[model samples]
Target: MIVIINYGSGNLKSIKNGFTKIGEETVISQDIREMEKADALVLPGVGAFGTAMEHLESYKDIIHEHINNGKPFLGVCLGLQVLFTKSQENKGVKGLDIFKGEVMKIPEEGLKIPHMGWNNLKIVNECSILDGIENDYMYFVHSYYAKPDDEDIIAATTNYGIDLTAAVCRDNVFATQFHPEKSGEVGLNILKNFVKSIPSK
Candidate 1:
């Protein structure tokens, strides 16, 4: 079973529908203990950084435990941002520090603030979650993106004036700045890949 965390700040229904469409079992709950029973956990979010971090404090330790133990983890949008050490937005609020990095706002020199549209991903490294998903368009809607301390952790990148981290994975922990749930077929395939890659319970 997969657990979609519901500490608030996510398009819960759309995320659930995405998994359900792929025929995967999932439960949306704020219960941290439910994570222990999950084959994999997904952190989906949309909104401000500090507020999200505040809500996540209650489950931060458990989330750290889950990812640290190498259980499969997938973060989306603000979900991806919170995996870093800190974010430039929201007065530089601290993140979960799951990976050594900081979130930076996408360069707005020649583009819009919230990169809201489909963008082609430039595959950086190989990972199971991105199998056969290279060069495909994924939906994005965010102002800030993660800049990991380790470039090797970046699974894929997309350009929004400057190359931005689009997807990241370190061991069993995986995250995407784009909403795979709203990216249509390719997006759903990405989620399917994650579900299929989980270690048997």
Candidate 2:
């Protein structure tokens, strides 16, 4: 079963419904024990960086423990941002520190603050999450993006005057700055790819 972390900061229903539409069983929960038993985990969020981290801290042990166990994990939007070392959105607020990186606001230069529309992703390093999908357009709604210390984790990128990390993955850990749930058919395919990646032992 796919367990989506519910820290009161994500588009929970839409995400859950997306998975259901694809015939994948998903459960939204903040309970640590339930998360520990999940086959894979999906961290979905839509809110401020500091507030999201605060909720995540309440279940930090569960988050860390799952990663330590090497379970396949996926993070979306602010969910993806929090995996980094820090974020500028919340001054002096530390992220989960799972990956060595920092999130920063997109430079304002003619473009809007919150990039709220469809954008094409430039695939860097191919991964399972993007299987069957080429460099396609996905929906996005965020003011900040992640800059990883290691370039290898960047699976894809998008341009908005400046290049942005659209998706990232290091080992079993994965994250996307775009909301695949709202990206249309291509996005649903990404979620399906993730579901298929669940390790069977």
Candidate 3:
């Protein structure tokens, strides 16, 4: 089953509903044991960086163990940010360090601070999670974005002031700055792709 990590963040219900609509078995839980046994993990979050990090640190062992085991894992929005080495949003708070990178605020050009709208993704590295989906629009609502040291991990990018990493995957770990759950049909398809890509339990 797909386990959605619940760390007192909003948007859990919508994520669950999206998976349900796709006929995928999913569970939202904060229990470490449940997370450990999950076939795949979906880290979903919508909140400040520091607070989210605190909640995640409580179950660091479970998360680290899962990723180390090469299990399929996906992070959404702030969930994506916390997988990096650090984030500037929370006064330079340290992240899980799963990947060598840092999160920085999206360059505020003439556009708004929080990029809240549909944006087209520029797919870079083709992967299973983006299978059957061309360059389509995805929903995003965030002020920060990840900058990985390894450009090869970037699966897709979106242009704002500059080209920002929209989706990234390194081995079993995958993440999207945009909320696929809220991106309508294309978004649902992305989640479906992830579900199908999960290794059998």
lDDT of 3 by residue, 113-191 (tens): 8988999999899878898877799998989899999999999999888888899988889899999999999999999
Model 1: runs farther than 4 Å from truth? none
Instruction: Quantify all predictions' global Cα lDDT against the true fold.
Output: 0.91, 0.91, 0.89
Q: Which pairs of residues clash in candidate 3, taking residues 3 or more apart in a chain or in different chains?
A: none
CA RMSD of each candidate after superposition? 1.1, 1.1, 1.1
**Could you estimate the TM-score for every candidate?**
0.97, 0.97, 0.97
Residues 45-68, candidate 1, lDDT per residue (tens digit)? 999899999999898998988887
Higher-scoring candidate on lDDT, 2 or 3: 2
Candidate structures ordered by TM-score, highest first: 2, 1, 3
Off by over 4 Å in 3: none
After superposition, the stretches of candidate 2 with alpha carbons farther than 4 Å from their true spots are none
Instruction: Please report, as a residue range, the 10-residue window in candidate 2 with the lowest summed lDDT.
Output: 192-201
Q: What is model 2's C-alpha RMSD?
A: 1.1
Q: What is the lDDT of residue 195 in candidate 3?
A: 82
Candidate 2 lDDT tens digits, 29-66? 87888998999999999999999989888777888888
